[model samples]
Target: MNRRLILDVDTGTDDAIAIMMAGLSPDLDLIACTTVWGNHDVDTTTENTLRVLDHIDHSDVPVYRGLGKPYAPIPFLFPDYADSDRTIVHPHDFPIASRTSDVRATPAVEWLVETLRAATERVTLVPVAPLTNIAAAITLDPRIVDAVDEVVLMGGAHALGNVTPAAEANIWHDPVAADVVFQAGFERLVLVPLDATHEAIVSLDQTRALRATGTPAAVAAAAIIEQRITGYNEILPTGAADTAPVHDALCIAYLLDPAVLDVAPYRVQIDTVSPLSFGKTIVDVDNRARSAANCHVALGADATLFNDLMFRTLSEGR
Candidate 1:
C-alpha cells in the first residue's frame, strides 16, 4: 500500500527536489503540500512549490500557505547567508511557466489539523523546512500529534553546523518552533539531519545521468541540483568537487526506503536561549542525561541507494 504523506516545505532547491520525489514516487500518496517561510519568504516558497508541481505535471496536489515568520520572536538577527553572492541559496532557477495550480484558501495549519484529525489511515508528516508550520499545527491542536503516524523532518546537525558554528539552517531559522515540536511527544519522530544529508551527496556526474533521462522532473531536478552543487562548492565546499547535499530530498528517500539511512534513538534538545548556540540540536548520543529517547536521529546515509532511487523515480516523471 502507498504511504499517505504530506510535505511541509520552504521550497529551497533541495526542498524542490524533495517535493518532486514525493509527488512522483508511486510508493507515496502525496495528499498535500504546505509551504512555510525558510529559505525564502512564504510567498516565494509557495509560488516555487506550485512551479515544481506544475513542471512535473502533478498539479493535482493541493498546496496551502502557512506562517510567514517564526512562531516566537528571535532574540538576535542571524546573518543573511542566502543574500550573499557566494552562497546563492535562492531557488529561482526553475523556468517560469504559467502556474496551473493555486494555494488553497484554508490556511496550512488549519488544513493540517483537520486532515490529521479526520484521517482514517496512517499519514506521515514530512517537514523539510523550518518547524514553524508543524509547531503551529501542534499548538493549534495538540491532538494532531496522536493523529500523525510519524514526523520525518530535515533539520539540525550532530557534528558541525551549516548556518552557524552550532546550528543548521532549518533549525537555526526557528529554534523555538523546533523545540516545541521536539517536546510534543509524537510517538515516532525521525530527524534526518545534516550528519546524514551531507553524506548523501549528489555529484555532477549523477546529475548528468538524471538529465539524460529526458523527463521533465529529471531535467528540472538536474538543473536545481547542479545549482546547489555550484553554491556548495563556492560556500560550504562539501569536501568533494562538483557535488552537493540535497538535504531535504534525503528525507523523502528515507520514507521510500528505510534502509537508505541508519538511525539511532537519542535524547534531542534544541537551544532557544543561548545566542552563540541558538538552534543547536543537543543530541545525547551517549545517554549522559539518561533521559528517554524522543527522537531517532539519522547518523549515516547510503549515497548509492539515494542516487539509485533519485535516478529511478525522477526519470519516470509523474
Candidate 2:
C-alpha cells in the first residue's frame, strides 16, 4: 500500500537527502513539499527544495513557501541579529542549492489546512524542520488534528543535544510551535530524535558506496554529503572526523521500515519558556508527570540495517 505523505522540510543538507529519499521511493506518494525556515530562510528553503525536486524529476510536486518564523513570535529581543538567525553555513556554494528561478506560490499554511481537510485518505505528515507550519495549520483549523493520520518528525534528543545542552536544532529553533503539536492530542505521533539518528551515521564508506552506484540519485546524494562534510570540517574544529548524521532522513526511513528503529511511546512535553531549556522535549519514562503518553519516541536504531536500507534506496529501492 502506498502511503500519502505531506513532507515539511527546511532544505538543509540532510533535508536535501530526505527529499530525494521520499520523492524517489515508489512505496510512498509525496503529494506536496511544504518549506519552512530552520536550516535557512524561507526563500532559501524553498529554492533548495525546488532544486532537489529538480534533481529527481519530482518538479511536479507542488512546492509551497511557508513561514519566515515560528507561529509564535520570538520571545527574546536581540537588538542585533545573530549569525544563528541567518542561513545555515554550508561548506560548498551548493550551486545546485541556488536556483532562484521557477519559484511557485506562497502561503503554504492555507494549502496545508485545505489539503488535510479535503483528503479522503489520512495523510502521513512528515515534518523534518521546525513545526511552524504545522502549528499554523492547527491554529487556523484545529479540526485538522483529527484529519491527520500520523506525524513523523525529526527533532529533539534523548540525552545529549546538538543545539543547546537540552534541545536539538529543530526543536530549539521554535519550541512554542512544538508545544502545540505535543499537546494537540493527535491520535498517533512519532519522533525520530537525535538519540536514534546519531546511531544511523553516514560515514565515508557510505559516501563511496553511494557514489559508486553512479545513479543520478546516488551521485546527487554523494555530492551533497561529501560537500557538507568538507564544510563542517573547515568551519568547526571537530567537523572533519564527524560522521554525516543525515538527521532529517531518519523520519522518512522510520515510516518505511519501523523495524529499523526501536520506538517506544512516552508522555512528552516541550519547554517553551525557559532560556536554558527552551525547545527541549522532556519524556516522562517514569510516568511521574501529568498527561498520558501522546507520542512514540525512538530510543535506538539498527544502524547496520538502516545503512542497508539507505543504500538500497539509492541503489534500487527508490
Candidate 3:
C-alpha cells in the first residue's frame, strides 16, 4: 500500500515542488497539506498551497492553515531578508490566475492532533517549513509522536548555513519548536539538511527539459526551479554555476527512493540559547558526546536518482 503522508510547508518555491511531487506520486498517499509561517506569512503560504494543488489538478488534497508566528517569540533579533530578492521568501509565479480553494476550517494544530489520534494506520509527517505546527501538535498530544511512522524534514545543515553562518532559515526561524520536535523521541526522524540538498542541485538546462514535458505540474515546477536558480545565483551561489538546490523537494525524493540520500545516525541538538549559534543543528558527527543517535541526518544525496524520480513524477502530473 502507498504510504500515507502529510506535508507541512511554507509554500515557497521549493516547498511548491515538494507538494506537487507528493500530490502526484503513486508511491505515496498525500492525505493533506498544513501551512505555516517561514518563507512567507501563513496566509500567503496557504494561498500558495491552494494554487499548487489547483494547477496540478490535485484539488482534493485538503489544506489546513497553521500558526502565523513561532510558538514563542524569538528572543533575539535576526536578519529579516525582506529586502532580499530570493524567490524562496517571495510568492511563486504559478500559472494559476487565482486560488481555487480555501483551507479547511480546522486549524492545523488541531487537525494534526485529531487526525493522528484517529488514524488506524501510521502516517508519515513531512515538515519542510518551521516546526511550529508539528511541535504544537506534539505539545497538545504527546501520544501522536507514536502515531507517526517517520518524519523526513528538510532543514538544518552541518557544514554551512543558508540564513546565517550558523543557521538555516527554517530552523533559525523557530529554534524552540525545532528543539521540541527533535527531542520528542519519534522512532524515525530523518533530517535532509543543506549538506544533502546542495548536492542534489538542478540546473537551468534541466528545467528546460522539464518544461518540454508539456504537463501542468512539470511546467510549473520548471518555472519555480528556474526562479530558485536565479535567486541562488544572485544571493547564495552553489558549487555549480547555473544550478540551485531545490531543498524541500529532496525530502520527497528520499521518500520515493531512500537511496536518494546517504544518511547516518547522529545525536543532533538545536542551539536555542547562544545568540551567535542559535538555531544551529549541532550534529555530533564524531560522537564526542557519546549520546545515542536520535536522528538520521542526511549528509549526501544522489543527484541522478533525485532528478530521475522528480522529472518523471512531475511530468506525469496527477
Model 2, which residues run further than 4 Å from truth? 77-92, 95-101, 231-242
TM-score, predicted candidate 2 vs. hidden true structure: 0.91
Ranked candidates (lDDT, high to low):
3, 1, 2
Instruction: Give me the overall lDDT of model 1.
Output: 0.90
The residue-by-residue lDDT of candidate 3 on 1-318, one tens digit each, is 999999999988899999999999999999999999988889888999998898888889999999999987788876755335444434445444576777899999999999999999999999999999999999998999999999999999999987878888889889999999999999999999999999999999899999999998898888888878877877888969989989999999999999999999999999999988888999999999999999999999999999999999999745
Candidate 2 lDDT tens digits, 1-318: 799899999887888888888888878899899999888788878888898888777788889999988778757532222244223334225546434346556578999998889878899999999999999899899998887889999999878676667778788778889998888878899988988887777777788988899878788888777765564454432333745577788877887798978999899998887766776789887788766789999988887777777777766745
Please identify model 3 stretches exceeding 4 Å from their true place.
82-95
TM per candidate = 0.97, 0.91, 0.97
State which candidate has the highest lDDT.
Answer: 3
- In the range 1-318, model 1's lDDT, one tens digit per residue, is 989999999987888899999999989999999999988889989999998888888889999999999989989777855356323855455543557889999999999999999989979999999999999999988988887889999999989898888898899889999999999999999999999999999999999999998998898888888998888877888898999999999999999899999999999999999988888999999999989999999999999999998888899745
Checking candidate 3 for backbone clashes, the offending pairs are none
